[model samples]
Structure formats: C-alpha cells, structure tokens
Target: MRTGRPRQFDRDEAVRQAMHLFWENGYDATSLSQLKAAIGRGITAPSFYAAFGSKEKLYKETVACYLHSHGRVTDALWDDTLPPRQAIETTLLRSARMQCETGHPKGCMVALGVMSANSEEHRHLLAPLDTARARTREGFIRCVKRGVENGELHAGASPDTLGLVFNSFLFGISTLARDGVPLSIIETSVRQIMALWETFSVKNGNELPNG
Candidate 1:
C-alpha cells in the first residue's frame, strides 16, 4: 500500500486571516484558539505549531504581510516626483480611503498596533509598526525639507514641527476611522488640514522657530 499524504493548508490565507484578527482585536486579546479558528480549514495544534512555530512568530509574519500590502498606501509620502503638497495630501487621502474601505478591517493595522501598545509583548511585537511610523514621520519631514530647499515653503520653516502635525493627524485618522467616521468626512477634514500648510506660506516663511 502507498503511504498517504498529510493534508495541506494555504499558509498565505492563514496569514491573511491572522492579520484581520490582529487588526480587529489587537495583539494581546487574540487567542490561540482564535487564530486556529480564523485560519481556513481549521488547523490542528500540531499543524499550527508546525506551520507557524508560535503566536509571536505568526504575529510577526502577519505584520510584515500587512506592511507590504495595505501599508503601501502611505508610500506616496516618499515619492520625490510628487510635489511636496501633493505627496502629503496623497498619503492623507489615500490612507483615509483605505481605512474606510468596505473589504478587510477598518483602520490601519500599524496605527492600531501603536495605540494598543500597552503590554511589553505588544511593544516587542510592535517594533515594525514603530519603524513604519518613524518612516512615515521622516517622509513628512523630508517633504517639508524639500519644500524649503526649493523655495516652495520659503526658508527657516521648522520641518520637524510641521511634519509632526501631519503625522499626528494621520494617526488620529485611524482612531476616527475605527470609530465609524465616514470616508467623505475624513477626506474633507484632510483638505482642511492641508489648508493649515498653506497658511505657512512664503509670506511668513522666514518666521523664527518660536512663531
């Protein structure tokens, strides 16, 4: 008699399901049972261990997956080709649209992870999220610096402060999105936020840092 083959499951789908669960309930709340249940075809404990090694490992995988996919929306921030204003606006509007989309979970996983970072385990697991956020903030800062260099934003405008404002707003948007705020309203709010940048025009650009 020929030896029988062990049943196989879709690992990619498993990570996707795990991503949604983590995004919905956060890091510490999601249980092993939940992960097993969420994964398609229902994997056994042995198979689960064999497939993922452990929950922490699986969480790392899911986070990486999230970054490569949904997280790319913010990548517009780093696009040097886009004008400074357009780059910032694109990231804001695109992030809002993604957070409010019908499919998958609402809100950004990275932002959600940051907010739910209460436990040490979460903090450790959230290294990638932290890096991603820092990258986003850096992107904003780069845009402001570029704007200054090109005379688009005038001179002596503090890049750090300007970048923080948008970064703070971007994270706040995740909270609003998770709170059921509609996309259209958020989009309008983004435009209003951009108007704040316009106020920092070349007219008052050379103002001191205290201003």
Candidate 2:
C-alpha cells in the first residue's frame, strides 16, 4: 500500500475564524471548545496546543488580523491629498456603516475587549489593541505636522495635543457606533468635531493637507 501525506491547516484562515468568534462573543465568554469548534479543525486539544501554543497566542493572532483589516481603512483616510477633517470624517462614516449593520458583529473587537476582560492573559491578549491606538494617534499627529508644514492648519495648535483630541473623539464615536447610534447622529457628531479643525472647512472639501 502507498502512504499518503497529511493535510495542513491554513493558519490565517483559522485566525480569521477565531477573530469573528471573539468579535461576536468576547474573550471570557468563549471557551477552548468553542474556539476549537469555531476554528473548524478536526484536530484535538493537543493539536490546538501544538499549533497555537496557548489561548493567549490565539487571541493575539485574532486581534492582529482584525487590526490588519482595519488599518486599510486608516490608510485611505490618512492620504496626504485629503484634508484632515475629511480624513477623520471618512473614517467615522465608514465606521457608522460597518458598525450599524444588522448581520455583522457589533463595534470593534479592540473597543469591545477593552470593556470586557481583566485576566492577565486577557490583558496580554489586548496588547495589540494598545498598539493600534498608538498607531492611530501617530497617524493623526503626522497629518497635523503635514498640515503645519503646508500652512493649511492653524499655527497655534500643537500636533501632539491635536492627535490626542482626535484619538479621543474617535474612541468616543467608536463606542457610540457599537451602541447602535443612528448614522445621522454619528454624521452630525463628526461634523461638530470637524468645525474645530479651523484649517479645513467640511462644507466645500477644498482643503488638501498636501496640496
């Protein structure tokens, strides 16, 4: 008889599945068995341990996947050709559409986890979320600096402080979006923030950060 080769697991797909499950149910509510079932591997606990090493590791992979998908949206918003206010507005509008959907899970996994877990493993699992926040702040700071160099932004505002304010607004809106706020209200709230930027007027969308 001829010997056949064994099948291999798709690590990325496995993590994506894990991410959706965790996004829907959170860390504490999801058990190992649930993870195993959700991942759809015929493998046993020993195999899962061998593949992912630990639940914490699996959680990290899940968060990384979520952030990777989300970062693309950030990339489009952070474009140098767009005004700072438009960038921020675009992100919020997109988020409103995604978060308000009836079929998909609620809010961001990072925001939801920040609210739900306290175990050291859970905290460790969430380190990626901290990194995502820091990256978002850094992107805003970069946009502010670019605006300053181009003379589009006001001279008095500090980039560091601007970044903090921007991040705070985003965080609050993200939480509200998770809570199922209407898109009209979300758009109104975003416009209110844009009014403070001063360099860019949301009315005409003419202010370009680079041009």
Candidate 3:
C-alpha cells in the first residue's frame, strides 16, 4: 500500500497564528524567533523563510488575512442598502465587538499594529495599515455625502467634518477597547455619540435608528 506523505504544516493556520502574534506585539516589537515559535509544529527558521519569504512579508500576509477575516465587518460602510447613519453605526458596533472578543488580541489589528514604526522598513511593512485607515475615512466621507444626497442630512452639511469626527471616534473606540473597557460600556457610548448624528440630520422628524 502506497500512502501519500502527510502535509508538513497547515499554512493557513500558521498564518493565522502569526497574525495573532503580530496583532499582540506590533511590527518592530515582534521577532522572527517569536513568529517561528508561534507557528509551532516544529516549524524551523528555514521552513518559515521558505513558507513566507521574510518576517516583513509574513506580517503583510498576516495583516491581509486579518483584514479579510476580522475586518470584513467594516464593508457595511459601502452597503447602499443601509442608511448612511446605520452603516456608520453598524461599523462602529461591529468593530467594538470584534475588538473585545475573548480569544483575540484586544483592540483593532490595523489600529494597533502600526502605531510605532521605528524604521523605513517597519513603516513600509505598515503601509497597508495606513491605507486601511485612509479608506475608512474615505468610506465615512462617502456615507456622509450619501446622507446629504438622500435628504437625510442638511444640504449644506460638510461631509469632511462629519467624516473626521466619526473616524476619530471609531479609532478612539479601538484605543478604549485595548484599555480594557467593557463592550457594554462601549455600545452605550456608541448610542450617545450617534445621537449627535441625528442633530445634524435633516429636520423632517428623522431619527437615528435604535440598535
């Protein structure tokens, strides 16, 4: 009987494990040795290099995986079916919940992973994080513009101002989640902050949707 050889390691699972290490320690703080240890199954340094090229390359892959998986919730910002306010609210609430999940590192991977880039190499590895944040701001701006166009917001409202405020609030929530704030408290805070959105809305008895 000829039996095929067993796979060396689960590549997808290895990437996920490495993602958690990077999420916990950020770029410069994480090390190749730490990554090798985390990947487990006796993955050697040569094996790590063969599988992922370099530490920077692996981190990039890990970030992509994280965004594609844990960060997909923010895609709601582009969902035209949802009212602008609802889309923004859904993104914040979902982000808060994901940040506080028990099994993963606290706070957002994108928000926390790129805070202290110590070198050009580190910053280069972190470019995607910056792009993600920029996209988030842009998405909020588009949502605000949609609100104005849909008659949900005042015609003279500034999308840039509203987008900045909400984007800052969302990032602040990520910091708060990392600082150990409970999800319930964060959700309550979201409700209060969203009330401010209603004050800017068009004056036709429109109300912010209750969660």
Candidate 4:
C-alpha cells in the first residue's frame, strides 16, 4: 500500500524543545540524534531535514527564538522613560531573575552561545549571538551616556568605563546562574552593584544620596 503523509506536529513546540537542548548543551555539542529525540520520536532524519533544512538552519532558528523570548529581559536597558539608573538596575535584576528562573535552562543563550562552538570552523555560526552581546554592551554605554547628559551622574563619569562595569557584571550573571547560585544572593549583589553607580550620581546639582 502507498504510504500517506506523515502526521504533522507543532513546529513552534518542536523549535522550543530544540532551543532548550541547544541552550543546555550548546550547538556543537548537541547532535542530530539528540535533536531528533528532543523534537519528537517521530522526527526521523529525513523529516528533520525536511522540517529544518539542516542542523545549521535549525540552530539559527533556535537562536532567533531565544532572542525573541528569554533574551528580552535586558530590553529594559533600552527604555527611556525610566531614569537611566533605574533602567540599568531593572535590566540587571530582570536578567538575574530570568537566568535563575525555573521552567527554562539556567543562564543566557547569548552568553553561552560562544561556548557552543569554540572551533574556528564553527565560530561563524555564532555571529548572531556575538552581535546580540555587542548590542547589549552598547545599551549599557548608551544608558550611562543618558545619565551623564541628564546630570544623574557626575560630569566626570566615563560612559565607556562605567558601562563596562555593568556590562561585565551582566555577562557574569549567566555563569553564576549556571553554577546554581541562588537568585536571592544575586539580587542582593545587584543592589551593591547599583550602589557603585550611585556613588557617582547627583541630584539637584548636588551629590546624590550614597554618593
């Protein structure tokens, strides 16, 4: 008897499943067999190829899914209505909480993406993640500049340097989260980190509280 079309599945759900595997294992580390198993037992090699074209294509799709979803926590850094300091604090707190939250992989895909493929041959595959990291770093610098422009920070504050302080801390959060550090501790540390910026803050042409 002639075979009928294979039963269909939820593409979004498949992608989400694949994304978690990639998040936890990294691209180079995760294999086609693992992806097929994670996506669903029914997804044979041919079906997998038909659905996603190739492993590289599927990996790129997962990256897009990640950026659109879990990666959005830092978007607070780009919000203009909140005071620059508040924006920075919100981004840090949000990202920390998210990286530590249940129901998803610990840590950030963007932060861990680089570790996915260390070999030069696969390095180009992670360009999107590299660009995302750069964008977040730029967001920090932009927020610092906004603070300085509005006198929220002292005139002597260096946006490049100050932003690096926050950016570096933000990047480190992923490692801490992955290492099973408690969210509460990270949050407490965030407060201290914010205080570091407060030391340079000003209000009404005078040194701000904690300055």
The C-alpha RMSD of each candidate to the native structure, in angstroms, is 2.4, 5.3, 4.5, 2.7
- In terms of lDDT, model 1 sits at 0.87
- TM value for model 3: 0.90
Candidates by lDDT, descending order: 4, 1, 3, 2
Model 4: how far residue 7 lies from native, Å: 4.0
Q: For candidate 1, lDDT tens digit of each residue in 1-211?
A: 9754474778998999999999988888899999998887577888888889999999999999999999999998989899998999999999999999987899999889865557865578899998999999999999888888887785777899898999999989988998999899999999999986776667554444357
lDDT of 3 at 1: 90
Model 4 clash number: 0
* Candidate 3 lDDT by residue in tens digits, 68-111: 99978689899999999999999999999999988888889877
Whose TM-score is greatest here? 4
> lDDT by residue for model 4 over 26-118, one digit each (tens)?
988999999998886557887898889999899999999999999999898899998888999999999999999998899999998879988
Greater lDDT among 1 and 2 belongs to: 1
Off by over 4 Å in 1: 1-5, 115-117, 203-210
Clashing pairs in 2: none
Candidate closest to the true structure, highest lDDT? 4
Window of ten residues with lowest summed lDDT in model 4: 202-211
lDDT (tens digit, per residue) of candidate 2 on 1-211: 8754343667777887788778878888878898887665655787678779988788878777777785355664568678765676677566656665665576666557675467775666667777776777787787767666666665555788776776677667657866778868877877777666764422344453442
- Provide the clashing-pair count of each candidate structure: 0, 0, 0, 0
lDDT of each: 0.87, 0.70, 0.85, 0.90
